[model samples]
Target: MDTPCAERSESYIPNAIVGYGYTEMAMQEMDEQGFGSDTPSGARRVSGVSSSRRVDRQTGRAGFGAQFRLRFSRSVMPRTQKGRIAGAVALFASLGLLAGAGYEGQHFLLHDERFVVPGSSAIQIEGNSHLTRAQLLSVFGEDVDRNIFTVSLAQRRTELERLPWVEHATVMRLLPDRLRVSIVERTPVAFVRQGSKIGLVDRTGVLLDMDDDSETASKGAPVQYSFPVVTGVSEDDPASVRSARMKIYLKFASDLDSSKENISSKLSEVDLSNPEDVKALIPDHGTEILVHFGDSDYLDRYRKFEAQLPQWHTQYPKLASADMRYDRQVVLEMQAGASVPTNNTQTAEASDPTPAPIKHAAPRPAAKKTAAPERGRPHTKLAAMGQPHFPDESAPTGKHVISSKPARQ
Candidate 1:
């Protein structure tokens, strides 16, 4: 008997499974089971069962156990071959369009005239006092005419900082053909004498190029620095050591300026050749008087010398030097052949008469006395002028007096 169409449709394999290479195999298995396209209901049922058994046995032996079961479901499989091919082509097309857009964008940025650096006037530079605008243009080089987007900002900034006076530099693109550059300049604190050449130096002892010509020399000569000169530091010295010496020089200069008497105004030169001993020369009465103040207690020693200057000037007309390296005392070195008073005794003798002598309890030994010279003239001596006076307990009446004695010549 012929099978009903509805019954035959239930036994036929769906098109979803045909894409998985099951259409020809299912047809061959059905023909072997004595069933054709016009098969009876009973034969169709037999063919369907036989084909399912053969497929499961082959796939299980081939190690596609789960895949074989998944292939039977229509919803789990790809609907058609044409849909997958179309999707792949669309994916490649979209990627190509994106790459082309990116390339065009890059090209526009590189060649756009609006983004090109217009001229030197378009570049806004600030915070530069030692370096001129023309000098900065030379540093930019070929980047001057290039588009702003193409300019290497980091490279330009590094070149700017390499300048002698620039401590730091920052570069920015202001868009539409403009660039902004700012600099932090190093400030000169003193003039450093390196061999015969003198150059400006900052507080950190970094030598700087004097391009501004702020300090002038003889007619048509190069610029010279007028800042206080610092010596004893050489180019061969280590950077750290030079920096340390600069700090010491600055400290001494500051101390001199902050003194009660403005010694810095009178200071023409400072000798730092000896690190442990700092000497200052003061111009007094058409001659320079050397003042030796040791490394430590500079301000205190300076004040002491200033206080005793008038007294020493009066006593010795040509006071060449006063050494205050000692504590509570200053050694006054007078000019050669300058005559000073022998002692206070001559002054006292001229003003008052001699008093009574002291008496001892027992008979005292005779005090020895040296014979005077043939000329019978008092010999010159060196004396400590500013020694702190303490009351003499041995005296009949205790009193603090200005101590003066003949200095040994």
Candidate 2:
């Protein structure tokens, strides 16, 4: 290097890259290192700058670090903006493809024949007791042979629940040509007599008309329920009113049978006309007498009646009804000159066929149509006798009254 300044300065100037991420002093310092005594006056006067190396050993090139820094820094910002744009395009393209696939799949499900409900056999029913398949199938008659997805499950469920036997029903699509219907049948709590028509009633007071086909079919046997006949629930009464009366009736039975001795089984009929004073007809020894249990303490009242029955039977030879609602005494009604309703007399005859018919208010006109029961099985008739009058708490003398604890005893 006879003339390092002239030779190197010429080469360094050609390769020096001016760009961002650099200071003026660094460039001046780099220039001083590249040049020495022979450096030109114009180049030596430069200051407050920084720059990269003047040469690359491998290629004998100048300003390699500076060129790389300038190119890399300059491209970083522009490439970042370009990368965001490209990523946005790719995301939008993926979403469009997904939406298209979804639309196509939905179309296939709606119109595909493979998914159509074939026929009545494609429908599956479960959890039915007395409900026949024909009766439940009637609800989905229109849905048969239609696309399973097109069938409104909610609408079918509502229609199924409207049937007398269904307390709750669930309808669902069973995929690829079928619908499934599940029914929760209403439980029969008591035998309800609407006029002369005998049916079963649930706790909610909804009357259930059992399937005639199932009963008559050779494969299905007749369903027999051991329950007392409940009165005061009429077809004309609103469901709320019927339910309210049924509540009182349920409480009466629950309380009487709390001991599990089947105390409630002794009752042949229960009158729920007055919630405040519920009445039950019980057969003790031979004669059946109606006992007024009232609203609360039914079990206690029933027990008290049982305890005092021996003394009462001895004292009164002909006992018709007893009011056990009083705190200390039970009011007794004698059979002679008694004003018992026709229901009591009729039920009495049903329980004991030997009893002669007692005279009552003239029998009401017979209904226009009555279904003749099967020859072997007899239907219980709980004829309504309007509302019966029980002794009031205020007027003890209205009927014959005696202390619950007898002085003689």
Candidate 3:
């Protein structure tokens, strides 16, 4: 379809006339030979005609169609330096976006107005005991009471928990309107008598000087009404006061109950000041009972006394005082001149001498023997008085004739 020169031109020039498979193989050979269209230096220096006619020097393979195919393939391949720069820029932009998003999220969570606390419309107190609702409200301070938004529940709990009677406490924010506090108060065990005033005290001996109210006082506070009045304990010694008073009351109650069980009279009082030598002032029995109870172990000693009391009462009916200081032995103090078993230990000796019987004159109108007064021996004398030696009918009231009885000598 062309002249001779035209035909040569057509064979070397890159065209669509070449079949697809041959063009591909020829292009691969040119690519391996370093003859590609992407090299701007190569494109400008080499004439398109010569480049199309050039052969792959190593493979001896080439054609205009093959060179054109190689050029197209090379143009499509990415440049390494440019591609790396683009990828790095994209990564940086993505990281910046992520960091900005995270910063915004944190700001919202920490300081946004949405997270601010709502105003307080109601106050929910723990209780009215120990510390009243009014008193606790005062501790919350003006800021917490005015603007509820700044109220720190944790801080409030920390401040109140320092109180000795408050065992534990929790402060909670009631959403939209209120704050509620719940606290556990320590139970008062006994009331300690402190001078003219009484202090409410707990089992641990912590004194609470709060005003008197039924709720703040312990359940057993009223039971201390009949407590023995004690002195010498100072206001500074709240712990010692509590310990001493509780010990006395507990011992007295235990002894009284045990005595009733044993048919013995109730104890008027029990003193624990000297714990080892506890003494009980018993009823009108004329003497105190000395009980040696060491430490706070009166409960055990009282039970022992109860068990042995009935036996002693039956054997020693005339006993004026009983000493149970030593657990194994019971000492009895009896009325003067009363007969006691010889085996028993008598604490006191006999007081006076026994009188000798007088010899009466022989019975009237009966046989009489002449009597002679003995001399040199201790002389016995009987003198007559105007009112008679013995009390007569005119003796002062409340006098009675008693037969001569030998008293202790």
- Whose TM-score is greatest here? 2
Error of 2 at 107 (Å): 1.9
CA shift of 384, model 2, Å = 5.1
lDDT of 3 at 118: 43
Instruction: List model 2 lDDT by residue over 1-409, tens digit each.
Output: 3455555553433323332334575554555556332434333322222354454434434453543221122443336777889888898999999999999999999999999888999999999768788888988899877888889888999999988888899998877888888999888888776665567789999987645666235366677777777888887999999999989888888888889987877776788888888887776565467788888999998888887777666656456678888885466665433444435333323434443333233333332233444443334323222322222112112233222333233
lDDT ranking from best to worst? 2, 1, 3
lDDT of 1: 0.58
Worst 10 residues of 1 by lDDT: 380-389
Candidate 3, run of 10 with poorest lDDT:
383-392
**TM-score, predicted candidate 1 vs. hidden true structure:** 0.55
- State TM-scores per candidate: 0.55, 0.64, 0.40
Which scores higher on lDDT, 1 or 3? 1
* Model 3, CA-based lDDT: 0.46
* Model 1 error, position 73 (Å): 18
Q: Tell me the deviation in Å of residue 382 in model 2.
A: 3.3
lDDT of each: 0.58, 0.66, 0.46
